[model samples]
Target: MNPSTFTVMEGEDNERIDQRLARDMDVSRTAIQQWITSGDVQVNGKEIKSNYKCRTGDIIEVVPPPEASPLTAQPEAIPLDIRYEDDDVLVVNKERGMVVHPAAGHASGTLVNALLHHTDALSDVNGALRPGIVHRLDKDTSGLIVVAKTNDAHEHLAKQLQTRSLTRLYIALVHGNVSHDEGTIEAPIGRDQQQRQKMAVTNVNAKEAVTHFSVLERFSEHTLVRCRLETGRTHQIRVHMTYIGHSLVADPKYGRSRSSPLAGQALHAETLAFIHPRQQEKRTLTASLPADMQALLDNLRSG
Candidate 1:
């Protein structure tokens, strides 16, 4: 394991070493605490506990094992709901609550882990952690995601995303009756300055995010809408919809508190279209709403 070093910034004043390590290293604080216990973590060349408060100019060092890296995904026996598969590409209807790749607080049972179990032919362009992952959906957002089997395919698919040729659509059940039948939301999305864990629509270091939405159905209080993303920014659909006063129902992060049977924010990746890597053919894929969302809609319709 190669040692990595970082100096505490002024903005990190009085932050816990483990918290800083998690942010800097992108590994969970649990893993960081283990490193602290093993004496693999040091501050200013002296050993310190995970809860040690960091001050400006404090140099921290970490030596972590490769297996403990958030980037290394191991194969698991989890089953995958594959929608389409070819030699060069594979499209899977990722289930809700499954992390797309290994990350902080999510080391296993990820889609990447299942993919590794299914095949060893995943493209390495995104490195060991992501492997063949071309795109991702939020953990609670169930939907279609494409994977590349070869580096050539990964590049081809990525170009489509960069050029805005790749199409992604989502079903969003949002709060309040949407006043308009259809509209476009063009906003810049960036990390929430106050809460680092959440995203917000802001011009400060933000990126162009455009979502075109149309009402699919309207209930007494909520509106079910279809969202088309022109630019894939982090939390684009959620943030944009919330920016327009229609945050998805049950969204723990950006939504108003409400009671619902759905396990997560009522959002689903319903469609994905792109040019095939090998065949150079345009392909579109779709998935039905999961049981929870469908059931919720059914109940709403009945009521």
Candidate 2:
């Protein structure tokens, strides 16, 4: 097994080794705890427990566990709004409420389940549970997503994502009027320690994340903004906007309680652009605002 090494920085002193490593590695704490239990994590070349306190000069080594067997995802008869499709890849306009892939409580009715039924083959780089899924959108945020049909295509798209060459643009209605016409949020993002279910702008074991946004329109109590992602961390846009005191309209997790016609956040993945893996050409796909988001905008305008 290949091992990764890190030095505990002065700022990380007294932090639990597992927690520090998980934050620095951008992985789950649970995964790091398992590694500690299995003797896969060492401090100064000695196996350490999960709660081992770190010193400023400590050297840590981590050997990741082997991949588990792939989960079998069953096909479901879920309808899809396919925007573009080719032998190499498929671009889909996912609805706001649809989960991208299955997980604990969401075992079916996901985009993966729909794709399985619609296509005979999908790139297995992400395993069976998320076959062909190159990226993801939150369940309450609707937008365009690309799926790979083959391993080569998956590798190409994934590489584009890593290089920040793929363009991901989103449209959101935020809860407050944005004063700046355009701005960028550059912050480190990590899972919230207090609220484990949420992502937060944190420096602890966090990754660099950037979101660029411009105001599209202004309302009395809200602003419509266009956000372009330079890094695609989970909930990057949402967290960044909230950090600036402009959470999305109707956002349950980050926004203040208010009355709204919408059931979820007013966020949408409106555009996706990437170099085609097979055709060797640039491809850009867009999805219009879904009915619910559009309706919210109309309501705001009419008031």
Candidate 3:
């Protein structure tokens, strides 16, 4: 997979050196810059800077790197509700009450553990504890999640998420009916200074966060809503919903009315969409709400 060499004639060049090389070689500008930095790209058969202008009669040598497998794939006997799996990625339906990864208070039986058991290869970008975790659902949230199997896959998926190219949608039953049929929560989210355990919309040490939601079903005192995330932040959905005066039903920490029947928050990650890391095509994955949450909603609707 090494890049091929090219001869630049005096009167045929008409673009920036990097752009020209990228177009001529069918590569990316970033890749061309990388070659220049590594001294593998040269003008007139000699090493040149990335910004070097091309002249007529210049011989350009491009040494493309060898294509190697991104990581080692291993198979382990871990139980998983696999929604999708390919050479570069996987999708899993995470059950309600399942932690994404192991933490101090909890270890083993986590989604990571299952992944390790199910597949041997996962991107090391997030370290050993988290192999392929690009985005995360809360410990109590159940839904579909995409996982990367290699470094290239990890980088590609991470970039999509950072650029807001990915779509994450959730369904939740809140304590009260919303006043509006649809609304957007354009609020910044940051760590709570007073309480480290909570996230809040504040000006200090914050990042931009936005949530768009529409009502799905309305109960006498509860509302089921579908929320889409435009920006990812820690505890984003929970925090934004609480800030807007309708905390998720059964969320003990944020509930205002306090007449709770469920043991945990009634939230579910219903759908996720992103570009395929290897195929470069868009893909969407979905999952049904866990039985407990579904039953809770049913009971709410009936009562």
TM-score of each: 0.79, 0.79, 0.73
As a whole number from 0 to 100, the lDDT of residue 255 in candidate 3 is 58
Determine which window of 10 residues in candidate 2 has minimal summed lDDT: 64-73
Deviation in Å, model 3, residue 61 alpha carbon: 47
Among these predictions, the greatest lDDT belongs to 1
**Residue 50 alpha-carbon offset, candidate 2, angstroms:** 20
* lDDT digits (tens) for residues 1-303 of candidate 2: 467999877787998886787688877665566566445677886666565899999999887767411234689988999999999999999998898887545667899999999998799776556789888898989989999999999999999999999999999999878999999999988768798568899976578999999999999989999999999887898899999999998888988898887778999999999999999999999999999889878887899
* lDDT agreement with native, every candidate: 0.87, 0.86, 0.79
Model 1 misplaced stretches (Cα beyond 4 Å): 1-71
Please report how far candidate 3 places residue 237 from its true position, in Å: 0.6
Model 3 clash pairs are: 3-64, 10-56, 74-120, 76-117
Which 10-residue window of candidate 3 scores lowest in summed lDDT?
67-76
lDDT value for candidate 3?
A: 0.79
Residue-level error in angstroms, candidate 1, position 291: 0.6
lDDT of 1 by residue, 1-303 (tens): 567999888887798887888888777766686577445687886667566999999999887856574345799999999999989999999998999987656779999999999998999865566789888899999999999999999999999999999999999999999999999999888767798568899886677889999999999999999999999877889999999999999898889986778778899999999999889789999999999999999999999
Instruction: Write the number of the candidate with greater lDDT, choosing between 1 and 3.
Output: 1
Query: Who is ahead in TM-score, 2 or 3?
Result: 2
Each prediction's RMSD over C-alphas, in Å, is 8.5, 8.3, 13.4
Q: Write the per-residue lDDT of candidate 3 for residues 139-197, one digit (tens) a residue.
A: 87788889999989999999999899999999989877799999999999866769856
